[model samples]
Target: MGPLNVSLCMIVRDEEAFLERCLASAAGIVSEIIIVDTGSVDGSREIAKRFGAEVLEFPWSGDFAAARNAGLQRASGQWILVMDADERLLAVNEAAWASLLRQDTAGYYVKLISYVGDRTGGDYVTDYACRLFRNDARIRFEGMIHEEVVTSIRRLPEPEGIIRPSPITIAHDGYLEPVLARKNKKRRNMDIIREALRRTPDDPVLHYALGSEFFQNGHYAAAAAAFQATLPHISPREGYASDLMLKTAYALRETGERAQARRLVEKAVAHYPDFTDLLELQAILLMDDEQYASSLLPLASALRIGADVQRQYLYNSASGSGTYQTRYLTGLAYERMYRWEDAHEQYEAAIADRADYMPVWHRWPVIALLLGRTADMQRLMYAQAARLPRSAWSLTANVWMNGQQTDALREMAERCEALRAEATVLRAVALAQDGADGQAIDLLLPAASRGNSGDALLYVWALYMKTGASREAAACLKREAGGNPALRAMAGLISGEGAEVREEAYRLCQQTLMQLAAWDCLDALHAQLPAQLPYPWLPLHAMYGYLHAPFASKRELLAQCTRRFAALGYAEQLAAGLLALECGGFAEAAAWFAAAGRQAPDRTAPRIGTVHAHAAMAQEAARGYGLPALSSDYRFLSICDR
Candidate 1:
């Protein structure tokens, strides 16, 4: 009935941005607030004062435990709650709070829900942190970085009953990309962790911390090495054992060692069958190698564990692996296996679980498209659009634009007034492709002159080139590029003196190339493309394969193009193989066709192309051996012709 009298304690430095949010979340619950400011130049101290916190200035000794100990010493309550400036305290277990404080327990493990990546959305990893503890003199914090009170608690007598798990959850954003950059936390933690490792050379905790720092910063190779080093000493009894194994597998995954990663995850899963993160990771590794059937096993097991594991914090598993996200992954597996209806059902379940999930949003409609349910797909698209704010029309349009779903895009343009510009660009592209070059230019010039042109300008320049005004087209493109890297790359690409561009700009280049190819502009593109490509060069190969060829000799030229597409990926294999078939290289064409057949067995084109390629190979053999060509052998001519 009375106040729980929980003391909220934290140590902060230049955390003015998140300090207020942290304090506000706990203001109604905590009896007193104690924030030890470690030489903050910001309003962290002032913000603490606003929440009626006891602000203590502590000199930065480069030891988090020391600073934390100072705050623990100042706390005057039955229980202490530790939190970071970037963390917001969630619900407290009031039912157990009084009993746990009165009973024989050193502390409680609070669930820490940390949002990963740049966006602070649904995707998060959960861990149990020792943030709740008794305000005891003997239970001060330990370790230099990632200081823990549990270590000190374990040092006391009868440690079996010392620690307990609670329903308290803390939502952490310190791991989010932008926040980590603003705080310069990755470097700080790595420096401190390395220094600690120097003192205690073979420390499992320090190595784990080092791996985490590297993993969060996208240095997966270094993270894998750090995580591997910890494996020799860590036991399953360790709090971070499952998490350590999970992270190690992910590090390998990131570094393109999927086979090794899958093996490690399988072994780890065997060791920790109940670990949801391991199960989810196992599914991912299986899916990566195109083993869709095997992937479903782990995914099903993960879902079987379900909300039971999600509700608990045994390991730092992504929050949705046991729920909607797992379903989404299952949907992917089914989709890859071409089980359209099954995939559709899983995607539906995922949407039912979390309607706003963008990953599902993109794939859900595609399933309907796959089933030839265009009307159903349109309905699904409308349902998703209805959820989004009207101001996000561009975002909605972009999803369709990226997919090149012209019909869906046109439908959206008809429904939303904000999409008129995008609709104009699409219309201009279509007009230019249909040989309406002058009309296309007229439609785009007004948008360009008014400085509102984005993709439209690219169409304008291409249309100008179509009119045989190369000089003016170059000038128009230069004006359009001005300072934009994407436009600059487009110009560079067209002039046959290409330069490297950033990834974002390169994607725009890819998108623009698709439009340019539609307008029958491959001769310029093929001549202008750089010798080396930055992947996703599908448009180049796709455009070239459609050439109205004489099927004449150009063996070396076509071979070089095939090799380039091969380097990019198997996405353009059929197109590349068809081009090879057009040239005078029967054996080479057959090889390309065979590779493409293996890549897409379900597709009729690759299979038919393979038959034609073999027929050509037979004809070439006939020429070499002085025999009748296969096409003249009436028995197989029909199969080869059609």
Candidate 2:
């Protein structure tokens, strides 16, 4: 145990991209490196030699196991540790390494984590492989692809207790989306499997391999057929049994055969009742069919498996995911079933596991609102907002402003104004939105003087969008906007002019209007719009109002907007106009006005959208507010007037 005698054995081809890191991680751990190069045209051979490896050349025979076996033959250590070039050995203490190799074992089932998305980190699959084994002539790898030495080691006498689990871990990113697209390894693997299948047509493992290759490349129908073909021949005792079962179910599900998938995984879990992956799959199948209550049984079973058990068996673990992800999914199921308190508990559990995960808490404010916990919505926003970096202040404030979370947004903006100009612009925007133009202008005038504070740029935009600032005030904004076409679009919006819309300018204008949270601004932008820009990001629902709002669905949203506007005390005309623009058609509104026979809008029938008809009412309604003098596009100038 003074120094562990370990040989790092690997077969690599054109792996120059990943070789250096792989060798470096194993540098101090392995005594020697045995690399079998399979016709590499790149610097794989040169890089291997730099690491002092005894490189052996093997002509491309399209057989992974044969190439690997050749490398294993050159290993001259008491213990052989096999790895792939795209994998890295996780760092471990020297004492731990020595203790692992000193164990009384023929081989060790090492933990293998294979990432499936971005290599920086995302979802992954994990499993155990007998990667470290005693160098024996009888113990060699087999199979054309998905090769392993476990079957060979099992042939030895009393093999059951000899191959025990170990703490050794290796991370592999070869299967990540970018690597898979670049390497096209799936194509080569499928070709080898098909050739081997011709030689042994009845081999279940080969059938499983073919199915796996098909699954990886997204050929679900073919994968499903191949997986079905392997079922009768597959043994429950095989290392791939659980994965095969899960992949088969996933393939069937992808091919629009969820019923078949449910039946298949439901049957498989009977054998692996304690397997977390299979149990989760069973629950997922139930959830997909909207049998959410019933799905809880399997989810509860999956949760009961304990963390150690969860770690021990991650077979096809992409479905198993992680505890937090599973709990998040469970929360969705409860939410769909209208079990709010139960769903809240599940979400709390999910967030406990991943408190700072943005995706998990992305809509938590809305969730609190849905639960009728207004105070909780404020609290959660404050908590998440407090943790944001300085760079995120404006964007986050813009998001809150656009969403019309008035109290929270104004509070955060006011708090941030003292810290930075970018945040100060947000405060100015908040004031302008609330009709406090003089106070907002005072804040923006000095902010705009400080050269290049992006905060000042938006402060100017607020002046143009909300405050009806004089020419002198707009000059500071013009200087701040520079030559950006998107910033220039606001001039046309406020001046009653039209221009062909550029995508950037158009998006900026749309976002600015939404951020203002003013119905008149939103309505004027669309009403005087030069033409519809086909940008996908354009909010058509916000643009055409109830024109996009399905006629049947406007009642609730109208009620909501109405009550919110009513609470402000000075937004009666604004509320009615917004209702017409957002939930009722302009032509229908005009007809309601015509039906009122020139009477004041409020004197008209209250039902059948008479209030909405106020959106296009006559001069009596337009007078005294100076609506016509401000801008031709300014439709509801009296929105804030008492």
Candidate 3:
């Protein structure tokens, strides 16, 4: 491998913070660095110059693919390696890149390991994009936001180096910053996406991109509609349909239509059973349905499909998405089924196959701890802690799993204080949970006083709700709702505020439910709040308390609850069973857990805890349904518990 000529191509704008790092990482490897500046007032061009990159000033083009194609034209190397400013060349893949360039592969499909700041490790949301292609092969780019290099890649005349499943990866630290900035970037992107949509209404790819834009921007309703609009126009072309269908399913799920989403994915899988993207979707849906057993089939299929590569795969050029992403979903599904061993195996495999992935390490021990594998959990926690800072989520998990309450509590307090008001609402709940109500009250009251009072009131409400002060909680909510329109709307629906209020509440709930966790009711108050639309990133039931209310027949509610339980995945089955218990279906709810205990593939602690909780509730019910002696007339309420 004697100094193989490599062209380092990139399109950038205001990437001064990362340009030097990126260039330095590829310094010796690249024969030429072709930098296409898309309007940089931040001296990004100067920085590129410092790194000896050939900086070309291209007027800001709305099309990312076009800008990239322009850069490719400037690249004069035997092989072209495309990269992003915020991405770094990982040390792990250094050898792979060096070796592959010497080989006769068509092109190498490099992996991306993305990291979100303050989290544990890299996200295993891996994808294989043709980064290294023979320059004479003439690969060009297409599309806007998520552009393509189809034209240029297609020009490669020979069966050149095509590396499909190479161990090489680029470390993506682009998301390792403030979320507000990310949101702002996405907002700008939405403008372009909206423009694109207007120009091409019938394009499924555009529709999918717009839907993703909306989803990322916390605009679920619009996102869902975009995806729905693409449904009739979904491409049935062999490989492409899987990608389109998967995106649609995600949009569907985020919009609260779980059943419909599942059906769409099922159809896609039927057409392409081994499609990794569709298989990942199917696995997620199955996990939601608490059908852990059912999920195994598709997940296994995805892994097998993803791992089976004959040789280096090349992308000559297609305008739409050619990359597939599902490592996160598969690893997550394994954990949810309580198969800690399998979960660990998958996470490691995903990372080994793509080490630039950072997030998988964040949640690895969650399943390990759930399975009572304390030693394994500890080992992973410490390993993760070493790789990340003390404030990172991985380190936090280590403290939490090891029962280092003092340190974890202190760390959480710092984090809560560091976050803005909207996020501070959650800090209040954590504080309250840790028996620091005084501190919780201090952190919540000032923010709650403002009109922006999100779910802070809910934390206080939870305190009252837990202490058997329903009337007090109701009264407090009324006052809070009176002051804040959003709070009022939510209070109206849950507490029967008024007709106008209930309608408003429903709209808000619909908007915000996607960000909320799948199982908890307490966290969903933000969604149900009547304020403008709730933030889409807010996790609902996963963090909040929900009361299903009295049903006409326990059987119907039980069935509904069972399906709901199944749809959210087995990790939440316990929560669903609890709801079933509250709905007066004690035996059925208890039986659900009993079945789970036997059938669950993973041995996570949450599963074990849920089984115990359900059993205890069942035992309490067996003593007499925990029901008051009913009069001949049949009454459910007992003095309102005032």
Q: Name the top TM-score candidate.
A: 1
- Alpha-carbon runs more than 4 Å astray in model 2: 93-96, 160-162, 306-311, 319-322, 355-359, 369-399, 406-429, 437-463, 468-511, 523-642
- Compose the digit string of candidate 1's lDDT tens values, residues 449-535: 777755777667767776778788888888878988777876776766667755565545444534433323434455455656666
| 384: Cα error in model 2, Å | 8.3
For residue 558, model 1's alpha carbon misses the true position, in angstroms, by: 11
Name the regions of candidate 1 deviating beyond 4 angstroms. 1-3, 91-106, 154-162, 219-222, 252-263, 287-290, 307-310, 335-374, 386-406, 414-443, 462-475, 484-573, 576-592, 595-642
Candidate 3 off by > 4 Å: 1-3, 92-107, 117-120, 136-138, 155-167, 176-183, 231-240, 271-280, 287-642
For candidate 2, the TM-score is 0.71
Clashes of each: 0, 2, 66
State each model's CA lDDT, in order.
Answer: 0.71, 0.66, 0.57
**Comparing 2 and 3 by TM-score, which wins?**
2
Write down the worst ten-residue block by lDDT for model 2.
633-642
Error of 1 at 86 (Å): 1.7
In candidate 3, where is summed lDDT lowest over 10 consecutive residues?
Answer: 633-642
